[model samples]
Target chain A: MFHNDGFHALDRQECLRLLAKVPVGRVVYTRQALPAVLPVNFSLDTDSSVLLRTPASSDLVRAIDGAVVAFEADDFDAVARSGWSVVVTGRATVVTDPAEHERLSRTGPRSWVVTGEGVFVRIESEMVTGREITVPHSTD
Target chain B: MFHNDGFHALDRQECLRLLAKVPVGRVVYTRQALPAVLPVNFSLDTDSSVLLRTPASSDLVRAIDGAVVAFEADDFDAVARSGWSVVVTGRATVVTDPAEHERLSRTGPRSWVVTGEGVFVRIESEMVTGREITVPHSTD
Candidate 1:
């Protein structure tokens, strides 16, 4: 009953669940007053926060630190014509604590862009929302 | 030779060609002065513009018209650990011309979210860039 214009809105719990399953997603941040989406691998923390690892000297580290950002993940089938999308809006803060870093290293997302100094950025979820559309079943 | 931190930057022509291959992507627009990425089905136009068909009554239709937004499309293999992402920054304008819509229909990306007023929103590409990371060749 949550359908709207063929896409149904998902609740907070479902959104988090779906997000936790996806390994790769895009992060949107403000770049010179315009938005830019950067694809990255992320891990969902126990507290519902998002952990992202990137190069210490990369643009992702430079653009967002203690700044508001958004992350999105989705899965869909082209032929079957179905999918779900979960988006999280939060603030990203660079983790500087060594103990926290070590703890996060054991549980946080591993960096995909290798061969650079790895840095961890944690996004504290402020709002989460999702939508899904599924293909209709055909009766035999 | 273009590799930096294990990722290679794609040129402009390569970025556009790659963008045309994807049918589904996310569009980032300003919602309440914050960035929001909405998954969308889009077509790459002849002039390098991005075309998206959403419900006329939808938020994408409402928030993007004449507004600067971002569009991202990518493909990655989680197991093989390789992928590329191309992001385009542009301005979205609702297509009011029926003739243009008809022409676009012949070659443009088809609408996915059904059951609403189909409004054509074309994002004029102002800048485009992409990066790809390839899996390392294994030598046994």
Candidate 2:
């Protein structure tokens, strides 16, 4: 669907596809009654949940576990004057089962930064939305 | 300040400086009690406020006006394994006064998409924080 403002709305399937193409994104969560954003490398789980690996004691885990959060990823071309952005918003929780954690350790996204004793956090894809801005071609 | 996970914290002055270097960012706000994020092109006002120009009737204007929002901008090099991200959290208000609107129309950011009757929304920099990840040089 195209909006009057030149943004073309993307479907859920297309949003997930675009998400898989990027390795890093920003996670938005509430901090001190205000919004906070952090860039992190993430991957999609088998169930299409947004998966993140961070230090077990990191502030992110403390703030986002059992809380609603938003994950956003996008790519843009400055010269082309176009880009697409995808956002997933849902409740985030820490994966506590040892077996699942071990499984994710082997298959999940590799942490961009070095860390010790990492834990897996999953943001359920309850809502996924995206938009694309395309440059209009001129017919001269 | 450097965190154990390799993130070097940046001060407010540096954060604003980095924000001025980018033309685009993601704005995070609450929509129906869930977080929503959208990519936007913005500029820094003289008082270091985040300035966004969008259609007057856009959803973003409705969702963020007089609300706390988060604006984040970053630049990263996957191959170099280095980047910096700056986030500004503040209250956003639409410029309603005709005089201020006219002044901003001449000095504010240009909307990335074509729009009719643009409105300027200013997000005050109440809290500015950032982090940088630098590739550590090996000492063999």
lDDT of 1 by residue, A1-140 (tens): 22556778889999999998888988899988888888888899889998898767777778899889998999987666689999899999999999988888787887765544487899888999899985462221
Flag regions of model 1 displaced more than 4 Å: A1-3, A135-140, B1-3, B135-140
Which lDDT tens digits does candidate 1 get at residues B39-96? 8878888898998876677777788899999999999887677899998888989988
Interface RMSD of 2: 4.0
* lDDT of each candidate versus the true structure: 0.82, 0.86
Q: Residue B5 error for model 2, in Å?
A: 1.6
lDDT of 2 by residue, A5-109 (tens): 888999999999999998889998887777778898899999999999888888888899999999999998755668999999999999999999989988997
Q: What is the lDDT of candidate 2?
A: 0.86
Question: Model 2, residue A92: displacement in angstroms?
Answer: 1.0
Docking class of 2: acceptable
Computed on C-alphas against the true complex, the DockQ of each candidate is 0.49, 0.47
**Model 2: how far residue A91 lies from native, Å:** 1.7
